[model samples]
Target chain A: MNILRFITAGSVDDGKSTLIGRLLYDSKSILADQLEQLEKSSAKKNDNGEIDLALLTDGLRAEREQGITIDVAYRYFSTPARKFIIADAPGHVQYTRNMITGASNAELIIILIDARQGVVEQTRRHSIIASLLKIPHVVVAINKMDLVDFSQDVFNNIIIDYSKVATQLGLNDVKFFPISALQGDNIVDRSEHMAWYDGPSLLQFLEEVPVENDTNLKDQRFQVQYVIRPQTDDLHDYRGYAGKVQSGIFKKGDRITVLPAGISTTVTAIEIGGKEVKEAFAPQSVVFQLKDDVDISRGDAFVNAAEAPELKSELDVILCWLDDKPLQTGNKYYLQHNARTIRTIVRTLEHKIDVNTLQPLEITSPVTLNEIVKAKLKTAAPVVYDSYDLLPANGSAILVDETSNSTVAAVLFR
Target chain B: MSAYQLNYLEELEAESIFIMREVAAQFEKPALLFSGGKDSITLVHLARKAFAPAKIPFPLVHIDTGHNFPEALEFRDQMAKEVGATLIVRSVEDTIRVRKLTEPKGKFASRNWLQTYTLLDTIEEFSFDACIGGARRDEEKARAKERIFSVRDEFGQWNPKLQRPELWNIFNGRIHKGENVRVFPISNWTELDVWNYIREEKVGLPSIYFSHERELIEHDGQLIAASDFIRLDPEDVVIKEKVRYRTVGDMTCTAAVRSGANSIDEVINEIKATRISERGETRIDDKVTEAAMEDRKKNGYF
Candidate 1:
């Protein structure tokens, strides 16, 4: 079965965790023993006779004590149709960095909107982040439908308001669902209360949504991770470059070029687990043997010579500051792109994104924690990359602090 | 451009291989924590594929509780040889004798917790900057919150709240001297996924995973494996049943399930029909408390 990795984002009390809990509970994914424990804990917490489904995703003791999700918590469940991995991110603006981290690898995103309030500020901020991250599919779940008497008018009004934001952000694939996560309506099964609505349930939409076509197959990009050389007597003089195929298809006799070094070679062989394969595609970890010996090392990349990526020493990037230390001009960091890590300096701060209004604010100060900004960066050495709009896996990078080595920013090249 | 994407198992394998390569490139001294379990065995297989045509870059470290199944020990030795990797074994028996730590006694006595001390000692002795293990998020609630590259303090304690934010495929494996990162490459895999991978890859495992007639004793509604370490009480009834282990841990604490699965295919089918979780049916350590896994992980138990 295919795996659908998604994220749930919403403001506090919008029931992000409750929605996930409902999905797990309604699908029979929650085991009997786990349900029993949940009941006991719910009774102890005394949530006014209501089982707090939020407690299920709040795994850390600190999160449980604070009654808020502080970090990204991953939850797994599977139906007969597909496997689901949910990255439940905190909704508070201060934890926007956590949301970015969760949404980075997500193929789809479920943005929850409380029915009473339509298209609030948090909703717009999250939508902008989703568009910025290039999430392929978006599901705006209008939660707490029971509170609004399951009114189709309320759901429709919210959709009308949300559509404008989606249009402004250039989100092409947006779906809407009205559901009561607490009362089990239109989440797993259809809701009888909403006779006016005619659409697949949330689970149904997730099961049918296509994800495989998102991979970039026209451009072949493979970053060499490690050099494999078995220096034993029997297998002497054997050298191979091992890595995951980031994009496109590679065949045994395909002509490939080693990046950064600019050496051309032919793929002599492609092996997966000591067995030779005729061809491989994106996301398959394989080792390639070249016909001609080349000086390739870790961080070097290989691509189809006809469709090579842009190679440059400077870049314009959108960065989300993740560390507590503010990002300032002239501050140096280790820019890690694929397997390569190079020394980088912030040459200029173009502007900080006002997430609330979706406007570019002139930067008068350094970028602080949880702030997103577009900046120009200069690297010490030339690097090979594509626009993130073209290829996400190869175009994206991270800025690590030189001294602490902590990832301080998420970089998207333009 | 043809539409091609990896299946679930292939995607998992690719991600794991990527993680293994990151550990190899980022850390100074790394080791694969081999426990002779199915998960760790799969990890070794991935590591082999990660750097094929070359010997595994890291050594295999085993914290022997000295109560291991004979088959597991033999399998561990043979696997180390096949990979041509260095094998380092640290014994809990020696640590107990030297440190004067008292072992739990009576019917439920187990050396499982004692292995932590030897493991921590081995890390310090070898100055290993990173230790890769086969821990999946689906196993326990605490594991669900763990980072792929989990950072441990000098004392080997996990601070869940202080974990660094892991984004995309980029993992932060930086730490000071004496501190280490515990890497879990298969964090996204479920129990069924592991079994399916094993079946597809034809990975070798200990014979005990297959059904065989063994002497067992019933304790607290569980079929406890009859072994020298287990001190059966008067009420405990011994029986000869065809059983297979869903997970292999300390023999004293690992329970067995009645099954006729003698091959990998049968095991996969049985697991598909099984209702209980792998740990729920086998591991006794996690049943101690609601947050037992979390507490143990905080104290540096892998």
Candidate 2:
């Protein structure tokens, strides 16, 4: 079975946890002992005389006590068709950076909407973030339908409203499902209550959604994570550049360019698990030997010399502020991309995007926690990267504060 | 877009290797926390695959509780030598003598809590900046919320609130001195996935993982192996049963399952059909409190 990494984002009252709980429950992924513990916790936490499904994702003590997810809690489940990794992000407005963290790796995003409220500011913000992250698929689950009497008019109206936001955000691939997460409808099974919605359940759609295309299989992008050279006498001449194929495939004879230094070399040999492999595709960890002994180190990328990504000192980036410390222009931070961390200086703050209207707003102050801003960055050294939209795996990076050593911001190369 | 894609297992392997490579490249001094369990063995396998032809760039450190199965200890020593990795063994027995640590007193008393002190000491002793663990998010509740590159203070306390936002494949391993990061390469792999990987990779495992005849005592409906580490009470009845360990924690804490599954294939089959979670079925430590793992992690327990 293939893997599907996804994110679920909605406000606390939007039944996000209930929806995840329903999927795991229906899929028989929850074990008997876990169910027993849940039953005990539900009795103590829930006064509604029913199991508290939200308790499943709220794994931390502080989160369980406050009834708020403090961080992104990853949940795993599987069926015969697909294995899923759910990045359950908190919905508190201040936790937008956490959602961005989850959305960065997600192939698909499930944006929940209150059936009564339709599309709200939170939905718009989530959609905007998904678009910014370039998540391949967008699924809108208009939940709490049981309260709405499974009204077709309400569902259709919400779809119409969301589609406008989707169109504005350039999110063309969007799917809508009407259900009640509390009542276990339209999550894993068909919602008999909403027969007007004749579509596969959310789980069905997730399993079938083509995530393979999300991986860039055409442009060959690879980074050297480590240069392996055995000091043993028998294999004295072995110098292997070990890394994963960030995108596309690398054959033995492919002429690739070692980035930053821009040295040209041919992949003399490819070995996976110490065995010779003719070609290694994207996401496969393999070791490569070059014809020439180039001065390649960790963080240096290798790409097909013909269609190589740009190597520049200045970069345009959309920064998702994550740290409590505010960011100002000329402030220096380390930009960590794939395997490379380069000394970078913030050149200028262009503007911040108003999440509510998706409009460019001038940055009147230093960017603080959870604020999204567009900025220009200049690296001390030449950096090799593709635009985030063209190649996300090799393009996206994280900004680290040199003082606190905290990941300050999520940098999306533009 | 093309149709060439990797299966879930292959993908998990690739992700793990990526993280392992990051540890090798990012940290000045890194070491693998080898527990001699299936998870750590799988980690060793991945580490070997991560830097093939060349030896793993880091050492394998094991914090022995002195209450482990003989089979597991044997396997740990043998495998470390076989892979040409430097094995650093720090015992809680030594930590107790030097640090004057008071051992817990009970029928199920263990060095599980005190082992943390030894681990922290070892970290300082070697000045290891990163400790690559085999902890999986699917194994426990608190681990689910932990980042792949989790930071800890000098005291080895994990601050959940202060976690960095881990975005995409980019990991920020930058940490201050006297603090170390716990890098979990298999943070995404579940128990089933590990078994599937082991099967596919044909990685060797300890003998205790398979079925064997052993003396076990039933307590609170859980089967605990009768080992010399524990003080047997009059009420506790020891019986001989064909049992196998699901997890290889301290002998004072880990329980066994009644199974005749003598091979990896049979073990996998048993695990597939089981309804109980891995910890719930075998571990006696986590059932102590609702946030047992969280509390342990806060104090630098792996």
Candidate 3:
């Protein structure tokens, strides 16, 4: 089976946790013991006197105390066709850091909308995030359909309003469904309440979505993470570059380039899991034996010599400032990309994004917690990367504070 | 979908392999914290694949609690030698003797807590910047909230609230001089996923995982083995039953289930049919409190 990693764009009030709980509960993923525990710990029960479904996603004591999710908690459930990893994050405006952190690797985003309040600020903000992260799939689940008498007009109006936000942000594959998470309507099975709807249920759409083809197969990029040299007599002279196929395929005899050094080498052999394979594609961890000995260390990129990405010292980036301390211009940070770390200085704070309007406002002050800004960074040396818009797998990095060593920002190269 | 796409297990393997290689590339001195359990065995397997033909780049560090099942130790020794990887064993008994630490006393008192002291000391002695373990998110609730690259303070304490925001799969593993990062490559995998991967890969496990005739004591509906480390009670119901371990920790704290699953397929089926969570069904140490794992994690227990 395949895997679909998605983020639900709502909080407890929006019934995000209830939707997740309904999915897991309806699919029989929640075990008997877990259900018993839920029954024991539920603080809020519905009129039916059943366990609160929202308790399923709350993990920490602090979160339970505050009755809110503070961090991204990954929940796993699977049907026979697919495995789903739900990055359940808080939807309030203050918790944008958590939402973005959860949204970074997600292939899909479920932007929840209450039917009564058609398009709230959160809907636009989440759509902006989906566009910024380039999440492949966008879902608009118009919840509380039962409270609205399962009206088609309410569902269609929300869809019409969400489409404008989706178009403004350039979010693709916008699929909408009318669901009542509290009553389990149109989540796993088609709802009898809404007879006018004819689309597949949320579970059906998830299982049938083409998530397997998300990898970028055109751009060939590899980074030498570890150089394996056995010192024993038999394997004395063997040197291999161990790394994942970040993008594209590497055959046994393909020509490759060693970046930052501009050295060229031939692939002598390819090995995966100790067995010599003819070729390895994207997402496969393999050891590449080069034809000649190269002075390559960790963080050195391996790409096709035919299509080399320009190595530049300056980068135009959008920073999601996640720390309490403000991002001071002219301060240095360690730009970490994969296993490689490079010194970088904040050159300029271009602008701050107003997520509500999907517009940019001129920055007058240093960026602080949960704020997104357009900025320029100058690296000590040239680094190799693609634009975040082109291929995300090979084009992302993080900013690590020099003194505190905390990850202060996520820098997406534009 | 293209043929290049990998299945769920293969995808998980690729992610773990990438993380293993990342640790090898980033840290000056790294070690694989091996406990000879199925999770660690799966980790060792992934590490081997991450750097094939070449031996695992780092040493396999084992913090022995002096309360281990002999079968696990034997299997550990054999597997380390088979893969030509170096094994470093440090015992909790030695740490207690040298550091003058007190051992808590009870009927089934565990050295599981004391093992952390030895682990921290070993890490300091070696100046290891990273320690990779096979901790999964599905095992416990506290673990679910932890980052894949968990940074521990100078004293090896974990701060759940102070964790760095891990964005995408690009982990931020940078730490200061005294701090070290605990990397869990298989953080996304579940208990059933591990069993399925083991079955597909045909990875060898310790003999205790399979059903065998052993002397056991039934306490509070849990079947525990009668080990030398455990101070059994006079009223303890000791019986000889065919039991197999679901998880492997110290012999005193790790419980077994009465089963006839002598094969891997049967074991997988039994796991699929069992309703209780993995840790809840086997680990006695977690039953002391609802936040037992959380408290231990705060104090540097893996």
Candidate 4:
């Protein structure tokens, strides 16, 4: 069985929570005791608590009181064929940073919409953000179909509007499904009311989505986490480079180049748990032994020299300001890319994105909280990397303020 | 190693190694919270894998309640020596004498909660910036919300709302001087995944993890192993049974289950078929309420 991780984002009342609740309830993922508790809580009358499917979610008590999701709540459920991880994020405009944090590693983004309202500002905002974050798949779940009498026209209209926005961005794998989460239609099972629709159910689509090839496999990059040296009598001369295979495949006798030093060596062995393995691939943790000593240490990248990534001293990044403080221009911040940290300056703020319109606001000033902007960065030293479109692990970085040691922003190099 | 395909276990192993390195690189003084349990034993093995061909750089710190299983104590010393890592023992008995923690005058009363005070004292004594634990989210509800790099305040209190947002592969381990981070490398792993990984990695755990014939007493719908620390009641009759511990903790609080899972494979298969959670069978503290684990977490019980 495969594992799929997705993030759901929309406005507060756009039926985002209802959709997830419906999926969990319909799939028999909810425990019997938990459902009984939910039923009891829903019956207790107070501000939409009665029969409020949203109550099934919104775990935090404070979130329930405020009637909003304040943080990213992760939920897991598995069907026979695949397992699913839902990074349920807050939908408020103030929590856009939270959405980015939740959707960073997500392979799919579920953008919910109300059929009665067609397409709204928040819908376009989240879709654009998902595209910018390079989410591989986007499912536009047109929710609240029951509110619009389960009208196929209402669903079709929203799809047309969303298509225009999705085209402006580079998201071609966008899918649409009309779902009545309150009535459990077109979510886990097909809706009889929407006979005009001929697509798979939302759960079926999620299960069948192709996500294995999402990671870049051409560029074989291994960032040395730690250099293991044992002074034991049996293995005194042993030296192993410990790290995860970020991309591509590594095997014995593969010629690899160690970054920051650029010395080439052949792979002698790959060890997982004190034993040698024949091969390792992306997302696998295995220690590598080089045929020759190349002075590799922690924070060094090992790559195939023939297909090596570009080493750069500066990068133009699309950054989301995460901290509460405004990102000051011309400020020096430490950029953590992989294991290495280098001091970098905010060279130029190209444009601050207007969340509502998805338009670039050409600004030279500082970016405030919950704002996304493109900026040029100049690093103190050259670091090995790749384009975001090519390899996400090597392409992305984060800015940390050296003075306070706070993560100020998450940067995706363009 | 390459003959069989264990993709899920391998992914878990990869992520755990990444987290282990992050703790080593991010914290000033990091230590492993070893409790001589299967989970901690698996963690020690992963730590060895994370730095293969070298000894684990971090020291192992165990907050002994002095009510531990005798087999667990012997296993702890042997594993620490095998890994060649420094082991520091802090006892709740010390705190019970120095702070005069009240002892309950009952047969089943345990010193489980007193270990928290002793653990906090150990952190203060060592000034450890990060404490690596083998806690998995699938253990209980409260653990599900834990961040990979969890921060505790100066008083060692966990405020879930104030947790820092952890982005993709970027963990922020910065905290105040008095504050420390509780790092769980296996936070996403489940109990089945742990046993499967252990089986595949050939990690050696204590012999107590295997099924053995032991004297047991029935209490609170659980099968409690009779130990030296446990006093028998007049009505509570002792019977010999074949049992194994699902989890190893304080001898008084950790219960045993009727099982014949002597090998890791049998243990994994048993866990797969078991309807009750690991904590439900072993941890007495978790049987109180759904929020019991959360409350303990708030009070700095790791």
Point to the candidate with the largest lDDT. 2
Between candidates 2 and 3, the one scoring higher on TM-score is 2
Kindly list the per-residue Cα lDDT of model 2 for residues A1-414, writing each as its tens digit.
889999999987999998999888889888999999998999898677798888888888998889898899999999999999999999989899899999988989999999989888899889999998999999999999998899999999998999899989999789999989999898888988877778999889998988877778889999989889987999998899999899998888999888888889899999988999899998998899999988888888989878889898899999989989899678789989888889999998889988778799986777889888899999999889999989888788889888999898998899
What docking class should model 2 receive? Answer: high
lDDT of 4 by residue, B176-227 (tens): 6788999999887767668877887788888878999999999877888788
lDDT of 1 at A149: 93
The number of clashing residue pairs in model 3 is 0
* TM-score of candidate 3 on Cα atoms, chains taken together: 0.97
Single out the weakest 10-residue window by summed lDDT for candidate 4 chain A. A44-53
lDDT of 3 by residue, A160-273 (tens): 877888788887789999999999999999999999999999999999989766788778899878888877799989888888888888888999899989999899999998
The C-alpha stretches of model 1 lying farther than 4 A from their native spots are: A47-50, B1-3
Q: Compose the digit string of candidate 1's lDDT tens values, residues B28-135.
A: 899999988899999999999888878799999999998888888899999999888899999999999999999989786888888889999999999999999999
Model 2 DockQ (Cα-based): 0.81
Local accuracy of candidate 1 as per-residue lDDT tens digits, A301-397: 9998789998988899999999898986898898989789999999998899998767999988879998889889999998899999889989899
Return the clash pairs for model 1, or none.
none
lDDT of 3 at B229: 75
Assess candidate 4 and give its lDDT.
0.82
Per-model TM-score versus the true fold: 0.97, 0.99, 0.97, 0.90
